[model samples]
Target: MIEKKSITFLYRTYKKHWPLLLLALFGSILESASMAGLAYLIKDVVDDVFVEKSYEKLIVITSVLIGIAVGKQVGFFLKNYLYPVVIYRALREMRAKIYNRILRAKPSVYRKETSGDIISRATTDVERFGEISSTIGTNIITETFTVIGIIGVLLYRDWKMFMIFAFTVPVLAFALQYFGEKRKKYSKRLQESFSQYIQHLNQIVSGIEVVKLFHEKVFFRYFNRINSDLFKRQKKNRFYETVYLSSVEIVAYIATAGIIFYGGIRIIKGEITAGDFFSFLGGVLILVNSLQTLQRGAINLKALTPVVERIKYVLNLPVEDDKGKDFKGLKESIRYKNVTVKIGESVLLKNINLKIKKGEKLGIVGATGSGKSTLVKILPALITEYTGEVLIDNVELRGYSVFSLREKVGMVSQEVFIFNDTLRNNLLIAKPDATDEELIQALKKAKADFVFRLENGLDTVLGEKGSRLSGGERQRISIARIFLKNPDIIIFDEATSALDVETEEYIMEEIGKYFKDKTALIITHRLKLLEITDRIVVMENGKIIEEGTKEELIKKKGVFYRFSVISSS
Candidate 1:
């Protein structure tokens, strides 16, 4: 039995296509009833033309058969035509919904799942779901009616023949149910195996340079292993399909042969006419065809159950708590009181208390894994699963809308992600309504005039992840975006670490001027970048060990002194 929830969800999803659904249903009725009508007309063609020698009635019977043929053709056309519209439309809506849900999901949800798995669910799984949904929708209605009409004709013609065929129903039902569970089991496994294969493929393609340079044979060995597993899994799934279909065929043929033998004996005993025997056999054939179709439909729908569950899991995940009121720019202070962040059994940040006044330029220096990036990430509510209090202007961090909170915060990280789009469009992400002149001015502020040399200037398309641009050029474009955004708080998480010394120096000089009045938090390995900041905080082992003015920290000769000495060396 299909769950009520699944039925409700499917109905709501395609409610707008109900008119097409109705037309398809009407078509199926006409198509199935025509076959039933033909079986009834066979008695006339057999009895009247052969026994009575009635030539006049022959013209009427042929005309009626022609009309039934046309009706069936119209029905076939309607069912086929409406099905694709529903399939593609549902696919488009589902893809859009999944993407939107992914955006609204918390960062931790992404950490738990691989990008390739997510992509497969959105593309491959969604396509399969679409096909199953269309098949279930069309075949369920069409085959049900086809079976009913054919069975009704059989019972009306002769009860004995109907009883003989009905005896096979329980046996076929058990067979279909057993194989359907098997198909469902293998279908889920096949989908999971494909996700793993896609993940490996994505990894190899993205890191092809590394594989070619150092580990070609090792990578190929891994690739071949996954490929072989996929082949075996696919073959196993196909084997079950073949067995299920062949079993249905064998059972149906046995039932048909038994009905013919029994009915022919009755006709010879003079208990029924030749027309009656032939008409009963025709209905039996239609019933077998309808039964096969229904079995296939059932198996397909059962196999898709796991996919529907996967989709439901994603769609039902808790979206970020974005319900709070709008947040204007920061006015007073951002404070963290005894905040701690934990991931599984490991604690990333422990009882880290700190505060940054509005317009304060704070510099943070720490070794890798010291939680420097995680600290600043909390300000924008990007990493929300933490203990203790984070307040913005005396309000709890969760009190402000996440989207509104992010609007006030701008971040430029070491690894800048550039989409495969025009530079103009990339810049537009920060300020969509920015004019070309405004964009150029922001670019100038970030020392990113290199874009002007591109083939189409601002309109030039960057390669995937900005692959065509040099590292410095990509960094500059990212900085230009931040300048255009001009948020109240700016965060630089080793933003210039990827650039050469010359590029870093020039970019930092421009950034120094840009940070004049805005609240800035700079996390850098190069201690020299801390010169423009008002205060510096040194973190080690997820705790702020020392914090003071740069001169004061250098004078203390504590952790800051050792960091400075290492930087100079």
Candidate 2:
């Protein structure tokens, strides 16, 4: 049995296309009526042409048969053609909704769900659900109407013969229910296994460089394990599907045989004419074909249960909170009061009190996993779950709209992301209304004038992650976006770590000129970069160990002092 929730969702999804659906429904009725008409006319063909040998009636019968065929073809065309339009439109709507939901989902959701799982639900599972829905709209509805029409003809011709066919329905229904449940179980497992398989494949592709550097045998072994599990689940699912279809067919055949044996006896005894016997048999064959199609559709719908649940899970995920006033600009200092961040049982940031006046350039130095990134992420509303108050211009950070807050803050991180689009479009992401001259000026400020040398200049496609550009060039592109954005607050999270000595110095010179009189935070291990900052903070184990000017920290001989000494050596 299909769950009521799933049925409701599908109905809501399809109800929008009711106009086309009504047309398709009418076509199904016409097609089924034509089929029954064909069976009913078999009596005339046999009785007048064969039994009575009447030539005049033969012409009338042939003409009526051709008309029925034409009507049936028209009905087939309408139903078959229109349902795809409806289904495709519905599927497109579903895909768009899923993508929108994902875009609005909180950052925590991304951490909890793998990209593979998300991609599978958005793509593979949605396509599968669409397939099942198509089957229901086209095959199931049409077959159901066909069965009803044929049953009407069967009862009209001979009630007793119809009774024999009716006896097998209960048994067929039981088989359909049982096998359908079994198939649903295996289908859920199969889908899960496929998700893991896709996840592993995604990991391999994304980390192909690491995989090549590491032991190939280990990666291959893990991949083989996932692949084998996927194969096993798929095999089980197919097994149940095949058994369900075959069971329905067997029952249909047995019922047909019983009808034949009993009808033959009736004809021999003259209780029914040859025309009546043939016509009833024709109806039974049509009914049998219709039921088989209906059974296949039922099985497909059962498989849809898991797919629906997965899609609903994603659709129901909580979106990021976006209710607040628009942040215009920074007026005073930014302050963090006892802020702490935790992921499960592990603390990412300890209680920390900090303050940075407007236009202050603060440098943060820390080893990996020292909460430096997490601390900076809070200003942009990227990390929302913290146990303290963060104030911007004396107002609660959450008081400002996240969109407006992020617009005022610019971040250029170590892992720069470049979309597979033209350089012009990529730059336009920061300032959508920027003109050609504005972009060239921003690129020049970031020391990324290499764009002019490309074959297509700004129009040149950047390829995946700026594959066409070197590491230094990609970093420059990232900085150019910051220049275009012209945010009041700037963050450099190891932004130039990938650059060589000369490029780093040139890029740092430009950044220093740009950072003058702007609030800035720089997170880097390179001590030489600290020369541009008025003060520096050193963190360790999720806590701030020391903070002061470069000379002050060096005189104190603390974490920053040791770091600077090591870099100098």
lDDT of 2: 0.89
Q: Estimate each model's TM-score.
A: 0.90, 0.91
The CA-based lDDT of model 1 is what? 0.85
| Residue 98 displacement in candidate 1 (angstroms) | 3.4
Range of the 10 consecutive residues with the lowest summed lDDT in candidate 1: 309-318
Q: After the best TM-score superposition of candidate 2, give how far the Cα of residue 181 lies from its true spot, in angstroms.
A: 6.6
Q: In model 1, which regions exceed 4 Å deviation? A: 49-55, 111-125, 175-199, 227-242, 303-305, 321-325
TM-score of 2: 0.91
Among residues 3 or more apart in sequence or in different chains, the pairs in candidate 2 whose N, CA or C atoms overlap within 3 Å are none
Question: 468-530, model 1: which lDDT tens digit per residue?
Answer: 988878888899999899899999999888777777887788877776788999999887788
Task: Go through the candidates in order and give each one's C-alpha lDDT.
Answer: 0.85, 0.89
**The candidate that achieves the highest TM-score relative to the unseen native structure:** 2
Worst 10 residues of 2 by lDDT: 498-507
Error of 2 at 499 (Å): 1.1
